[model samples]
Target: MRAHHLALLFLAACGSDKDPFAGGADAPPREDGGVIGDGSTTVDAAPRMCAAKPSRVVVLGDSITACSVIGGPNTADCVSKKVADYVMAQHGATAYQNHAVGGAKLSGIAAQLNAIQPAPGPALVILYIGGNDLSPFIFQSDQQAMQGYQMIEPMLVSVYAAVFAKLKNTTTFPDGAVLLTNTQYSPFDDCTASPYNLSATKTGLLHKFNNKVKSIADAQGADAIVVDQHPAYLGHGHHYNVTMCPHYAAGQTPWMQDTIHANVAGNVGLAAVMNGGVDRLYRDCIQ
Candidate 1:
């Protein structure tokens, strides 16, 4: 949440191999390139049977996935749980893990990835990040600010590429995996109550970021899928009105907690979009 926390996370990532959750240097090798067990070198004599479809789903991100409301207690209504429920219903996936921490940035992804246990079959890894990175530039107007954002864009792409490379090299998902990343939707853009008045610039930057995400995913091939959340949230409303907080009209509830995080309704909507994306990807896999 703070700069100090980010610094610590980055320092930990520098030695990601040491992370206990990750397959560290001491992790037992898979018998036949299969899943690694918990610190046990003894391999199962028989090959473990894998499911017909992906049986596991892991979510990694910041507050959106963490879903701790500012005033409310942490609830199961968050996006990660919703997504897990959707996947379980649609794909029969029984195992789900959420590694999302509030206020996390792309720099924190390595530790999150390290926390995942390798799956024998293909798994769905949902990654929703970068919103916090864009937060610092939400209100900048100067040319210098524009230049700074421009510089950060490529760096974000490079970070994502590096994470993907690690997943490919270290994790053993024999049937193949789907790395689903998302473009953030601005809840503060056009909101009358928001302090940051640079809606147009902010929106433009979000689109630019989204475009880069798409480009990077394409470069990563079919294994990477970018779930575009920008359009889905935009279709619901243009201005985010916090005063009309938790705006509920005709069964439509507000999708944001403050200016950035999503509320219960918002998480459900996001899960729906994610569900659609996963459905499409799964269909392609079977085909």
Candidate 2:
């Protein structure tokens, strides 16, 4: 790799301002069969792929991290598909597991984690949730749903606290970190989403949610990946229809994955951002 490439990689692991989604020149696709933020720039080893000592990993969350396929198509990436595979390859014998379920409440997540196989060794836990439960509160116009998002705050904290507490008690999560993803930000406009995805109100709601996640980490003194990175990364932070949600909706075809959730390519980029981003956050948290 060139010096610039090395710097880019290092920055990816450190700099919060560096936006990988900001394509250099719409570069062409690589031979590896994945997508990039843009087609520009020379392709290299996938960030999710292993180049370092491998680590066992467990992912616990909602639909985004659970439902791995739609019909014949595969959706889960960071773990189910390439990232986990690569990590296994890089780490040289890493065990992996997914305990996430679609449409699950935080309560469900706690139970699922408890029931899943404990980590085999030094491992990382990717807790990619919040899209479903939070959305009801974010998009709901009715007082119940809207207010649900508000009260959902403490529910969320409880969930995280429970998860961390459990992980700490078990041997599975030793020195393992949580790759925490923030809520929805997309290209589609929520306000015009036929039923509002995010108006200013919902945006504020997420902002609060993000803060709560951080707060939980602070109080618990746990390691976590904070993805309040950028609105530009989540399709400029636009909201679309629920049915269009890749993590939730039953879209018409595999193509709809890109329209709603992160496509294979999108998730790969997400994995890159995540792998590097979380490592950065972990080091910072420990510091």
Candidate 3:
């Protein structure tokens, strides 16, 4: 490979600010298969011959999907943008759309899905939500919080089932589409600072939510993919703190923008996780 081609690969892998999503104009097309954002080549190694790639990619969720904190001139650093770019690069996708609102919750997902203008061809939908739904209980008393959390599980399960059902019933795709769901990861869970406690109850609820997401994916069968983000963000950095306290650790190099949202580096981390999930789908389902 030439130096410039190597450079493009690096940028794509890093989810850098540069035009990582630009059409693969400079580099020659891969005969084997294109690499994912994490720099992993496809396992099949044979050109995709089975399933048709998506014509459009759609992201649905809350502020996390909106890239609310990671905004800047380099919009490509956002997680949705990174995923869109990856699909375009790897699958020849032409369009990417995100319908994530800043404060969306699981209950509101149906409306988001309803609002989507279905594409004429196959569309990949990425769903990253439930953080807002659980955020309210983060600081509640253990007993009360656990009760609330317990109630949330059924709601989450129902909402996810409905969302998947809607996709399966309503969308019109020549080749078929896939739905990718994600587990929530909060840097605040790792923060040791006062008032930013990661209580045992909170931790337990987080695990439950993640398991719920996995269960939904399992129940949905091949079309649903779960991108586990909790493990990926663990130990990456401290949650961002607006009030400077001498005792509190500052945000790590590139993981967090605030107590809630991820910085550009954190967005890159998320993109990498999503990329891994997409690659798995290609190897196991598409191929």
Candidate 4:
């Protein structure tokens, strides 16, 4: 919260430069989580028990969470909007905040996490990260990319722990909040696509990273849910044809507008993934 500390945050998070993964104007790619870049500041609020449904929905992470499209408003048909709209329609009451930055990596989350002001009732904090961390290494050799994953894995653990520590306790969420995190989904379609073929070792890293996500969420207990997005996105990538992907089926189309970011239909798919999680896991609290 100190001026120097804020300065340090920006510096530490500036390593990879622009968000290599989910590009587009999700708002100028602030790795600082909009702290000083966008005039956002931290807030303090008292904790309260959860209602029948979450009273607040806070979305965090990269452009995917912001629903950054190729040539449109970041919020246009984004996953966050879909979820928010669903909550409003189903529950009739909620406050939604999307603090996701376009080019953010896990490091950017510290500022985003710090900025959250807990309100009454349990909340749902949806996070999608790790893609930006892995994206830069894609063009590198297999060994180099794996090394990059090794370097970035610790940051993921650290950030995820900080989030669970801050938001999973009684002071922040009295009845326990629902934290949704996910594995990275590939737009390369298992390396069968052109121009972005990830080597076996590089593709393996995806699973490894996803497993780490699951372990971290598992260790944090039931309050956290690790939605597996990788498998869900497989058949929807660029090479969905039978020649490129055997899983390709009728009516399937590319979910991504580019090699990194999701399209409108993809965002809708992502929203559906989260919505299903809420319905299955939080059925007691939500209808």
Candidate 5:
């Protein structure tokens, strides 16, 4: 988090009202001898092939990673089943874990990361967050809504900064790209009566925020892969599958609306973006 919010939110609790990221929960020391929470490591090498041996991939994000509402990643009938299936298709020895949980606000990301296993082999850490932080706890009135956004932005941004800093020079995945990305948002119903429904503004804000995160990645010298989910996430009016939900109505799925959350088709599309997208972060990017 930015230094100020770090001071306020650092004590007492990290997530779910408990001091989730307590010490000792930190990832084990790296073979590289780097310290945690200090931004010193920088991977200047180009992308390399996955390890010759079998590999374990770990995704740390919010509901998207955990495959929430949907099952966690490869769990039976989970939305992330699609994601896992695609990854497994290419790499037969691939084993992966999803640490994402829904409602995992900024505070929650730090908590979960502490508990996650460090990257095992040829690791690719996919991190997509900041949406829920951008989302407010439903406000009762317009004035309250404005106040909430004002108060939350810095807190959220600072948290975003600290979380980014910790992971940017990550001791985990010492051999691979630590891909930093933000959530993909499509259209959401406008708030006609409440400023609380500022979905579009939030959408606009994501671009700005992602750029800021990109800056952090640059500071640490890692890949800042931009996996824009907006275009593909488009539906009739621009809404997505409710975060972790899979039961889109006949009219809401990608097939139905062209932009709800990924039906099997949409999921595959996202996988494609992720696959080639990060190549730019570490390898090459065309103008």
Candidate 6:
């Protein structure tokens, strides 16, 4: 790790909270007095059956999805694992597989995806790569950053296209599958600070990259959805103030373990977002 990254890691501390995935008749109600809604909602017009519900969940990405944190990483504490567990519990999935590797880039994810073979039943593939691919641009000059993004842009499109195609192939998902892709979040939240002073240019490129993801997902049709982690995590970074972003309340504690990796609580929030995406898919009755 770089000196600045190490310093940020040293500053990080982990915190705990009640499991957000717990639900059902025995589940506790929310502090707000509303019954906590599990991914399985009971509202009318909500489709009770979804063919997209996976028999297994597969994860792909770098350290974030791998649950790497400031301290030693825990596979069970990461977002992907949490989401996988939720799927198994709520959707009757029998298994979960995670192929994520710490520090893996897009190319690494491509390899991981390619290695996966056709399996019985529908599977949900949760992809959360590309953050590492964009991390170095944060420290680059404006010209260099722009140049780097330009070079990576086409690769992003091509790689994602190939990945989605294979994911939807009948041989890969014999029964069927859902692709739940993620957008990267900013740990600095547009507020530049000491050590990895995030720049507007870097942030812009981040959105651009996410937009490319959104577009690709959109083109992939209803079975593919983009879990917009960026906006969902807006107020949980270094500038964890509602005043920083209109998306959430101000003055929230940072959910990050370091400059990039999310802490345990942050992973819970991410899992919630992932679950919510599936909830919507269930609502829409996506097969």
Q: lDDT, candidate 1, residue 162?
A: 64
Kindly list the per-residue Cα lDDT of model 4 for residues 163-240, writing each as its tens digit.
888786676667557787766665655654455444555455555555566656645534665566666677787767
**Per-residue lDDT over 1-287 for candidate 3, one digit per residue giving the tens place of the 0 to 100 score:** 01110111111011212221122332334343322223244422444333346788888887778776667312887899998898889877798878887677778898888777756777788987776665554445555555565556566667877776667654544446778777666464334445654444445545655555564564454566667676666655463443343223355354766555677888888888888767665543345
Judged by lDDT relative to the true structure, which candidate is superior, 1 or 3? 3
Which candidate number has the best TM-score? 6
Indicate the TM-score of model 2. 0.60
Which residue pairs come into collision in candidate 3? none
Q: Native-vs-model 1 lDDT?
A: 0.56
Q: Considering TM-score, where higher is better, how would the candidates rank from best to worst?
A: 6, 4, 3, 1, 2, 5
The TM-score of predicted model 3 comes to 0.73
lDDT of 2: 0.43
Q: Measured by TM-score, how close is model 4 to the native structure?
A: 0.75
Error of 5 at 267 (Å): 3.0
| Candidate number with the higher TM-score (1 or 5) | 1
Q: How much is 157 displaced in model 2, in angstroms?
A: 1.1
* Off by more than 4 A, model 3: 1-51, 72-74, 170-175, 189-195, 239-254, 283-286
Best by lDDT: 6
Please write out the lDDT profile of model 5 over residues 1-287, one tens digit for every residue.
11111111111111222122211223232222111111111222233232222255456666555555344577644434544554456544276667766656677777766765565455445665655654443333434444455555455556645554554444754444344354344434221123223444444444444334443334333233335444444442232344322223345544222222333444555555564443343233222
Question: What are the lDDT figures for the candidates, one per model?
Answer: 0.56, 0.43, 0.60, 0.59, 0.43, 0.62
Mind giving the per-residue lDDT tens digits that candidate 2 earns over 104-125? Answer: 6666886777775644455566
TM-score of each prediction: 0.71, 0.60, 0.73, 0.75, 0.56, 0.76
The candidate 3 region of ten consecutive residues with least summed lDDT is 1-10
Give candidate 5 misplaced runs (Cα > 4 Å): 1-54, 75-81, 84-93, 137-146, 155-177, 189-221, 236-265, 279-287
- lDDT-wise, the better of 4 and 6 is 6
Name every residue pair that clashes in candidate 6: 242-250
User: Which of the predicted structures, 1 or 5, would earn the higher lDDT when compared with the native?
Assistant: 1
